[model samples]
Target: MEIQLKLYGSSKILSEKETLDIQLPNNSDIKKLRDILTKIISEKYSRSDLENLPKTAAFFSEKDEVIDDSYKLSNKEYISIIPPIGGG
Candidate 1:
């Protein structure tokens, strides 16, 4: 299955791309997707950055609905990785 990922904030900086197209095996869950993303980011940046990824970012489905690592993804689903927002 193919999935589309939208990167935001720090994630965009780590990945060096606004969007990424990744191919996964059938029945891949969010955890698996996250691992793959981590690998990609780690290769481009530092391993420490990958460690902070899950803590600093939020995941969303194609509909912009927040999802957890256990969420199961369907074919062609779009995932968005957004970094934490701060405002005073």
Candidate 2:
């Protein structure tokens, strides 16, 4: 199954488009997604720059709420990745 990853903040560097398509096994959860993300950054992107993204980022469902690691994902679901924000 594949899901659309909607990017935000530093996560925007993951792709040129607003969203990226990620393929995962059936019934995968957010924890699996995090692992996949970590692999993607390490393989396709700069590991030093994004090595912490998977651990520090927050995942949001289409309903605009944060989803936990155990949250089950459905095929073709749209998930938003929001990287950590910092300001004074």
Candidate 3:
């Protein structure tokens, strides 16, 4: 199945895209998706960098409502990620 993914803020700098097409299993949970993204991010940057990031450093959603990190996802579902913003 294909999922729609969106990366925002600093994550965009690392990911280099506002959105992407993620192909996964039929029904993958957030944990699995997270694992996949972690691998993807690690490929772009360092795994330590991604590990040091706060959970709130990024936001995940299946639709509009905020979903728990453990939430499961369906095929072709939209998953948007908003990395933490920085400012003075």
Residues 1-88, model 1: lDDT tens digits? 9998897776666545678788888999888887777777767666575677866677888788889878988888888987787768
RMSD per candidate (Å) reads 2.2, 1.2, 2.9
The clash count of every prediction, one per candidate, is 0, 0, 0
Ranking by lDDT: 2, 1, 3
Q: List candidate 3 segments past 4 Å from native.
A: 46-63, 86-88
Candidate 3 TM-score versus the reference: 0.70
* Candidate 3 lDDT, 1-88, residue by residue in tens: 8888776665565555678777777778766776777776667676564553435554466545667666778887887766566779
Model 1 TM-score? 0.77
lDDT of 2 by residue, 12-88 (tens): 89889999999999999999999999889888975587899999999999999999999999999999998998868
For each candidate in turn, the TM-score is: 0.77, 0.94, 0.70
Candidate number that wins on lDDT, 1 or 2: 2
Q: What TM-score does structure 2 among the candidates reach?
A: 0.94
**Model 1 spans with C-alpha error above 4 angstroms:** 14-17, 47-50
Per-residue error at 33 for model 1, in Å? Answer: 1.3
